[model samples]
Target: MNVALYSTPRFGALKHTIQSEEQRNSSSGDDVAQPPSSPSNNSSHQHEDAQDLLSFGTHCDVKDCRQLDFLPFRCDSCTQTFCLDHRTYESHKCSAAPNQDIRIPECPKCQQKIQRPRGSDAAAQIQKHIASGCRDLVLLAPRRKCNHKGCKNTEALSFKCNRCEHQFCIKHMRVQDHTCSSQSIPPSGSDAHRLAKPGQSALKRAITAY
Candidate 1:
């Protein structure tokens, strides 16, 4: 019988044997398990869900019409929304615009020129006249003077209404009818009076009255 000679395993052969043993051990149920998710796979799933969630009109209930890009301003008179093309047309005139020129006279809805009753125009004219007269009185009254000792200055003692001739000092001219019997007496001569100069007194009186 012939016998073979036995030899020690080389370093590489020992390493390979050790690796094989490790691989077998790792395959057993006692080995640490890896997480099922991968970063790439998770990102893809998240992206798909985001796309589903971002759909704009899915929540809208309109059966056929989509959301309008632009909305129209509704006319108060006609109770209708006017599109851009029809906004400037005479048939859809804006009632809010001041009709100072009276060019667009007719009501776009009823097709009637808004009329002021005959006396209404007269009443408005009278109001404007009264306002102008009041302004004139305010402006002119400052030029008149009272003959009283302390009131001798050139400034009007009060505004005397042209119609009423009611005299009110410059202080009372704002609201009180100047023609009323109440006489606003100036401060008499005293130390307190001296401390308050004519101009200062007038200003203080005006402020107080105001």
Candidate 2:
């Protein structure tokens, strides 16, 4: 019988086969040891997370137009949240629009329109204007009547008489028309000119030139 020794060809062949199996096992173990890297799966998960975050926003309240708005506006009259297109009361046709933006206060003494700014108290603004001496009170004041005795005319503007220095209506504005108190007249032309009104001398000069 022939015995196969350690240095024979068959022993060498068996040792080579065992080494190949060990190398194959080591290669498979290395493949399983490292983690799987997929860039596409990571990017897809990130995109889904971003969409989930953006979904938390308000929706429009208009009928047939419920679009999502990240930043909504609130109407002042209706007090409802809306988008930019329907933020105004007229645009949305709000029911309470008529009662909202009219806050002008009238002056009790003058009956004139007082300008009241938005967000200001109406009563406080009126009180402040009254304390500041309302100009309409002086402008809308009653005109003084004629100073002539028993004269009932109060519609025309009063004029000052040059002779008596008394205010009268247009009918009695001339010195001769009313009671003349100054009977003495200027003797010289310079004296008459000095006594004449500022506009009377200019009017006379214009008339003479024309």
Best by TM-score: 2
Residue pairs with backbone overlap in model 1: 144-156, 158-168, 166-178, 166-179, 167-178
Tens digits of per-residue lDDT, candidate 2, 1-210, equal 246587689888999999999999999999888687799989999999989977876677778667778898776667877776766565566776654557678889667667765444455557666877775222233577877777867753688878778888888776656665777633456656776777797999999999
> Clash pairs of candidate 2?
none
Badly placed stretches (over 4 Å) of model 2 are 1-7, 10-14, 30-47, 98-100, 103-193, 196-210
Where is the poorest 10-residue window by lDDT in model 2? 134-143
Model 2 accuracy (lDDT, Cα): 0.71
Q: If scored against the real structure, what TM-score would every candidate get?
A: 0.20, 0.38
Model 1 misplaced regions, further than 4 Å: 1-23, 29-31, 48-170, 173-177, 181-210
> What does candidate 1's lDDT look like per residue over 1-210, in tens digits?
123322334655888899999989978845577768889999999999977766522221122323332445444444545543343324344455334533322333333333333212322333444555422212122356642335444563446544335444565453232323436533335645677688797999999999
Error of 1 at 19 (Å): 8.0
What lDDT would candidate 1 get against the real structure? Answer: 0.47
